[model samples]
Target: MEPVNGYYEASMNFDMEHVRPFLSQLEEAFSLGLDVDHLAKRVAEAEVETAYGCDLHLAFEGQPVNMKFSAWIDDIDAPDLYFYVTSEKLAEGIDAEMEKFCEAHGL
Candidate 1:
């Protein structure tokens, strides 16, 4: 497991940097109304699984959200899994963390 950008605190269990750029690209791609299916296709084209070094998806069980992101993680060689989160909740959490990180960094 490894940390990412000092922002992701949980053990990654894999290097996901390759997906970071994809994530950024997705954020940009959202400038216009994009079909969910097409978004999925784009994600597939990004090779998110291989890039993240894990098989994961934005939705688990089923359904996506406006502000949330999710991923599955496991120990090396373990079975793939699902991870889910609400974007609103994640944004709130991240804002709090950023506030603290910035304060600590004297920013």
Candidate 2:
């Protein structure tokens, strides 16, 4: 939502009502070969105002792409959730594909 640096990011107001559906679509669209069950569980069990994340080793063109991802809240009392995906160094082609993927998914 800020700079187009080493990551693509997005944020929203947090709500469990939106968690499952959003995450379901996210995993389905971006998981590639990574199992996001742990991330799913962590987010599901998170307190309304809490934030956390983990690295997801998803596949891109049959090669593993490790991305650091986090779900953060701006305020504990009135949480405003945000998601960040980081890939410090990526091949040019892969970065473009990932950017397209994010755009397509409205991330």
lDDT of 2 by residue, 10-103 (tens): 5555444454455555556555554556665666666755577776667654566665656654443333434444433333433444455456
Q: How many clashing residue pairs appear in each of the predictions shown?
A: 2, 0
User: What local lDDT score does residue 56 receive in model 1, on the 0 to 100 scale?
Assistant: 29
The C-alpha lDDT values of all candidates are 0.34, 0.53
lDDT of 1 at 98: 41
Best by TM-score: 2
Off by over 4 Å in 2: 1-5, 61-63, 73-82, 86-107
Error of 2 at 98 (Å): 15
Query: On residues 1-107, what C-alpha lDDT tens digit does candidate 1 reach at each position?
Result: 23233222321221333233333333343332224344333333443333222222343224543332334433223212122234434334444544454454454
For model 2, give the 10-residue run with minimal summed lDDT. Answer: 86-95
TM-score of structure candidate 2: 0.52
Root mean square deviation (Cα) for candidate 1: 14.4
